[model samples]
Target: MRFGMALPGPNVAAVDCLPLDVLPLILEHLTDRRDLHTCAQLSKAFHNAATPLLYRTLDVRVTMYTGMQRAIVLHPSTTILQRPEYAKYVRHVRENGAVGFHRPDLMDDCRKALKMCVNLEGFTWSDDSAEGTDEGDFMRYLDILQTLPLRELVIQTFYGLSDSVWAKLQDFSGLTKVSIWCMEGKPRILQGWSEKLGASLTHLELGVSSLSRAPHPLYFLSHLPRLRALRLKGAPSAAILEILTFLPQLETLDTEYFGAALTRYDDVPAANLRHLTVRTSSVHIQGFQQLWPWIRRLTPRPSLESFTLNAFSTQGEALVPRSFILDMAATHKDTLKRFKADSTQMTLKDIECMCTVFPNLESLSCTTMWSPESAPYEEAVQKANKLRELRLNLHDWRPTHVRLAGLNNANIEVAVRNMMLREGAALRLVGIGSIVYRGQWIYKKAEDGSDKVEFEITSNVIKDVWD
Candidate 1:
């Protein structure tokens, strides 16, 4: 049924007079599944538009009924051969638990759904319940997925990436993003995959086991074309830096630290990079130092806008070097907008220095880092004049050192915003567009001696969780 030229049925003709935009506006408010179903049946036009919304995400729940899962997929698989209309509506498919292969009818249902849903973009089988249930039926999943056009695919419980499995991946020529957990296949599987799909891949996440014992840890990343994002947790800093050298086009990078050897590498500034987040397994001085190479490699005046360094010290006392902020300012002073360094013991003077380093910073969150010192209160306030969203959770046990005491109590924040406004800062409209002043000092210290703090909760654009 070509909807573009099909004759409008009586059911659809009713809403045809509504403005083209009205349908979407009306549907946007109809978040309930039952309402969408009712709309789909009320009019053919609604049916055509609403059907996709109704079936956009199909999560196949493996059940024990054993009464034909295919019937559950298409509702009417027999009519599916005659009517291939349901295929276009589906975009994402989620599979969980035992999709029993013992039933041929169920297998046929899976086959039919995959075959018809040609426009499918994502397919995932990441059910924790599907563990130890690979009962030699891995190929059946590959067979089903090979027939669809997939952009993102996740495999949680798999026996291995055998030759057959690799061949199945070859079928999804458009596959750009993948996450494999139960990796039973060859160690060389990912390298081969990167070669085939690296050119088009934009996002890649690896959740494999035994990464430290692997022969070539960076083999998969070597062949990949410079993509938009890469996430490989628990990988050594050396291997991560080496792979990053190959991907200069990356915009977002998320990696972890696990006591990897940090060696200096030739700098290839990632000019396009915008966001960088690093998480450490355990806080070590070397872990903090390992971050230098990533920032140092950034091109002078880099495009970085957001940086999050979450280093958890074992003894609850991690320290961020002053040079880290200097390096950031050198590379992304003008472009840097958001900065978060967790559990680091930096003084208020350090934060004040950061405000100067990142002049354009709109958000700053370093709760655990800025502690024990509020000596630079006046200077810090002046430097942080431009910040719109701030989360400073430092050691403020006494009223003398209360969190945001001076600014939170008196109308000092309002005075600062007023000053900023007077200095040619545009008035920000809340919930309407860009930065708008909703309220300053969202939270307040409840005057509890147990190191506890309080904050105001507003359902608005900016939120500063202080303690």
Candidate 2:
């Protein structure tokens, strides 16, 4: 052994003899933090190898509270931070909580811990939206993000960023993926943040955020040639399609909450977009007759591959126009691999269109109120040779259940799952799903473990997440 250690009897390799560098390389592959934490306590050699990997992604929400964050947790007196050494290994810092930072002493300790993260590349802060004018408040904590090799910044709200803070952000470079969600859209924010942060960004997501004056913030941001991925939400539908035309290089887009309106516009030019997702969150938008009518306006793109249209109304009774499904399925038929839609209901014609139009589809989902005899889904199931994943949204069974006619009152809901696997024999898996009729439409995993999802909807609650 290199460290003057003798191994027991026959086997000669000592644990210490393993190159310290090689151990860190091996430890990187150990993803379970619990296992890594246990390994870190083994010896100084293992500790040194595992500690860096442990602090690699500093999620403040968990890091502030987790017992595993030994280096940052306070002592019995709750007045001291134990190890400053752990901070340097942090590369991603996500701060979604403000637990121990109330006292100046504790806040300093937290900042001191963060100051050592010179290698931090990613940072997210959700509490920056507070309106308190306290100097060196949460913004001071945010300034710590500017120092490191910051690459991704996902800030929740910018409620009180002054001009100076905004100016600092403009000069702060090296950002690539920036997602500003739930922003208050104060006057100052609508004016400059996009233009300030737009230059260095490649993947930008602005959801439920507002912009200043006439020429929309997105319209102004379209000039930035570097943008490749975009997600726009809480904007008028009238302006969104036009904005897409402006960004010809965009490869991916996810948008929703388009304020319903019938603003007449010319044909939208097709870009090299590959993945597109359009969603209508609130059922309040009455004009959301269908997702395809809005999508059909766009000129066809040969590069388009994935399309998802989630049209959710309050009543769970919104319709997804057949023309929209057929047209989209036809336009992206060649390259389309994944297609998901949540309409009021779907029929055999819709399923046939989807199965036949998309031969290369690897994944397909629909919020269809399925019946055993409604459509011969078997029709196109054979043609969809590459089909691997299929998710169906059927009516929940309880008081009155739809049954497969011949199968002894067999819930057609369950029968549909078998039908998919039997018909699309090439399918890798068929996931059976149903929207909750009552409390939050949650998708619960089937306890029986036949790769099924069984949900018992209760209450009149509602959920916002996509099915």
Candidate 3:
């Protein structure tokens, strides 16, 4: 009887005594996957607890083939391929099946892995071929997708899918967000198919290759009652306006180009629109003036929240006037929150005028081709009090003898610094200089009421400066 008596170590009993539910909570705190893998190997209980968390969010991107190879090499001991318990954690992959000449066996294994992931919520299919054909394999993968309900689906194809596969997508009733980047001719067939699934779609992105022609698939989106976000690139402005008229509840509208013809259709207004982005070299100050007035004339004017203009170019030798920007901001001041302009030859005075108009703006970013004249820095700072994010490009300022006549390097730096400080707690990011000053960049951040500024100058800039 005495020989049968045994004693336990001090912490041994306590370690085994902890509840099984607490294991997951502890493993979640681990930051690195290697640390989690080590924890999993400690015991079978630990393995079961950590395996799901580790296997969740599987990335099968073409770029991550090395990681896939490693996973395959360790498949025998890890048994992740055969284990059903790990399937629930698998939510996404860059590709669904195999392709090309390498690793032919990986195709079957990857499909098997995908099948086990019946609870997947996100899926992205990116084809590497510039002109390669994968229609059959793509169709097979789409068939498999029908089994899993997904919230997000992203498809990037160098060429378009077959019409049969596009028709089969009607069954994807649970899809809420979809992004399609199809080859030039392929998007034409999508019109009817998109209309079929329009009721359930909330976010839709279409990137086409043709900008001069009408988007053939435009009619398919005419009934997207639930659609809130719509992004169209490389499509004619007429087609874009046609789509905008259909989306009654639309919240976001982003277009790559605004054709000169858009001015003719100013009579059609998107009343429910809130966020708008126009990345067009065609838009000038005059075009914007004509466009904004029509937008303001909507019966129930849209509460435009965020506006972005990119790649804007002006005719002849013209600079964006300070008063013009100020007037535009004042017209939409009540509902605006974020305002951005890039690639415009504007001056510091023009930016300050914008700040005065949209004093409640939370995010402000502008690329000016002309630096400020050494006037009063406080005036610019006072106008940008509510700015949260600020981006100023001194390189955007043209170094004309006329503009930089009286300004020196010290004066330019002081003016830029003052503009940033005015953003206060709202400033989270800042970028300075151009290609010539490539490495000479400054960034600042504020945390817990403390401000930190960092200056990083590249070797190229330092060498050129000293040379």
Candidate 4:
């Protein structure tokens, strides 16, 4: 007798059944590499949707090595080399010169794989090896990279670049962003880059162990008419802003915040500057004293959107003077949205004043000492109804009288949650007492069209929010 064949089950394509175009758009939002890896195994469609996202940024940098280990693990570039198609998905590659030391053949693999990355747009090269470790001709990799469609270049090395490598970099005309940090002697790498890549270079960062005594480290940078963001280390704040007089299109500046006041400020022009970060130490008192006047001289009122003053002191705690806050509020109150001052002290009254004065303040971070039950804390949050994020460093705030009673994590969470419920409907993040919680307000439209809001708060590790 003839046996009947088993019937086919219902066809179900799972979530991967979405159109090829729509599926990629959804998969691209997956930030966790583990999730993307799992999705890549679901089906050919899912693999196609997630492969590019997974391989988009190839980080083959060797972070660590131990003598106890056997042979070094093969670099990811080896896989890209074997599977030529995966090379096409690598749009950015971060490599440390140490990768070659881990295995002599790794550099060859990286060079071959990089060539296959015809669409590569960004490249980050770092060398963390000991001083005498052979650099193994950076020119080899640069030669292949120059042929690609690279647009962003970042180099942080302990040793200086050879003249040939620097010249090869000058030939890279399509670069839109360049960051070079050399821990060696004074680096004069920006000599002629302005004439070559200035039209496309919008973001530039330069750091060096030593700086020349010239009026400005790189005078040629003034020719970069389209420069929009400039970050400099080992450069005086006064000298950094002097270039701003020439960079009319510059919108953001990050630099060491110490220097003498500008010798000639009367001719200073109004800049489009929006975000400024001064990462420095309080040891430079004279420089700090001159900083306020320099900021005030920016001409005209309020255009800065974010200001971060990260000042640390080796002698004792540094404090941001209320006068400085008052000056900032007077000039930038209307536009300042994010303000961060770390390691420096801000009192409860200062925090309260910031909230009350800066109507548009969205993110505020500072080290402050305030009793959770104090009126200043209450007033600060009440006025900070519009603040979207609040981060406070209160490690120094644990007073002998209230440390056992009120400084515990449980109590702090309860007190902060109450503050959020009472005010700060717009608040989404609260960080204090070495703890971070992320919350969101869920709103419903009322019958009268007024909004009714509900909220949810959950504890989160620091990296989850502010990595």
**Model 2 per-residue lDDT tens digits across residues 356-398:** 8778888877765545543454554667778776665655442
Which regions in candidate 2 have their CA more than 4 angstroms from the true location?
1-32, 35-53, 62-85, 100-104, 128-135, 158-160, 183-199, 212-215, 257-267, 281-286, 370-380, 397-425, 434-467
lDDT of 1 by residue, 260-369 (tens): 47567665544367888877746445555555655556434468889887777665557667887787788788898888775555666677788787878877766433
Off by over 4 Å in 3: 1-56, 61-84, 96-101, 209-217, 262-270, 282-302, 312-324, 370-378, 396-428, 434-467
Clashing pairs in 2: 439-458
Error of 2 at 264 (Å): 7.1
lDDT of 3 at 85: 71
In candidate 1, where is summed lDDT lowest over 10 consecutive residues? 426-435
**Candidate 1 displacement at residue 76 in angstroms:** 13
How many clashes does each candidate structure show, in the order listed? 7, 1, 6, 0
Clashing pairs in 3: 191-220, 369-396, 369-397, 369-398, 370-397, 388-426
Please tell me which predicted candidate would have the highest lDDT against the true structure.
Answer: 4
What are the lDDT scores of the predictions, listed in order? Answer: 0.60, 0.60, 0.60, 0.72
TM match of model 4 to true structure: 0.86
**What TM-score, to 2 decimals, does candidate 1 have?**
0.68
Candidate 2 local accuracy as lDDT?
0.60
Stretches off by above 4 angstroms in model 1 are 1-51, 60-84, 98-108, 129-137, 158-167, 183-189, 260-264, 267-272, 283-287, 298-301, 342-349, 368-388, 392-467
Error of 1 at 265 (Å): 3.9
